[model samples]
Target: MDKVFNAITTSGEEGVFQTELCKSFSLDSRDGSRLVGNLEKQSLITREKALYNGRWTYKLVVKKSIPVDAIEQKPIDLSSVEGAPCICCPSQHLCSIEDESNPISPAKCQIIEEWVTISFNKFMMIQQTEII
Candidate 1:
């Protein structure tokens, strides 16, 4: 099972066809199907139906899992909002969502909108760089 799972994972995002995977392990069709079925039941892999060389087959792909420890270790980074307009605005104290009397509400603030747009673009660029 471990070997089968590792093989599927090593195959990467494109995944391996059911017949080919079975052939690689020298297992018969029944055994191979059963093995992959167990993996799918365990939520360790997913099978997609595909046409391989005009023959129907199942494509086995590994499920991506994020470690809980990694999520716990990563802290929320608020540096992106460092230069936001609201941070140093003199009327920040007067800004209110429910009060119609306040003219400095974030909902109608152009400066805040521009700042958010710029910050979002920067965040997207950083995300793309990290992915690369």
Candidate 2:
């Protein structure tokens, strides 16, 4: 991290400073120009671009903001007892069954098949916690 910081701020009296990416990281163009763009195609550095002093240089592109990705979900058939009856009705049916003995009416457990997926965003926020 220190090396990265140094490379980013590697400025001399001539005012020319640059650093090749040591590792894949989120770009912080506070000062100096870090090369960007696909190096294979051509140089991505803009001499006039900067987050502060009008100079940002880098070879690899570091996208700061990231969009979230939606999660996928699939529906499945629910397991049900064909002849299970609701407490209220003697005949087998799919409904709530209330207990008469207890003042609190508890319904008979039912088979509920649900499907859900978790969505995640590829956000790169500042680290809030440090692992000691």
> What value of lDDT does candidate 1 attain over all alpha carbons?
0.92
- 1-132 in candidate 1: lDDT tens per residue? 999999999999999999999999999999999999999999999999999989999999999999887776767897866898887888888888998777879998998999989989998999999999
Cα miss at 110, model 2 (Å)? 60
Model 2 lDDT per residue over 49-92, tens place: 32423645433232222344443456565433332333344433
- Name the best candidate (by TM-score): 1
Q: How many pairs of residues in model 2 come into backbone collision?
A: 9
Runs with alpha carbons beyond 4 Å of true place in candidate 1? 70-132
Per-model lDDT = 0.92, 0.32
Error of 2 at 30 (Å): 22
Deviation from truth (RMSD, Å), model 2: 22.4
> Residue 56 deviation, candidate 2, in Å?
7.1
Worst 10 residues of 2 by lDDT: 114-123
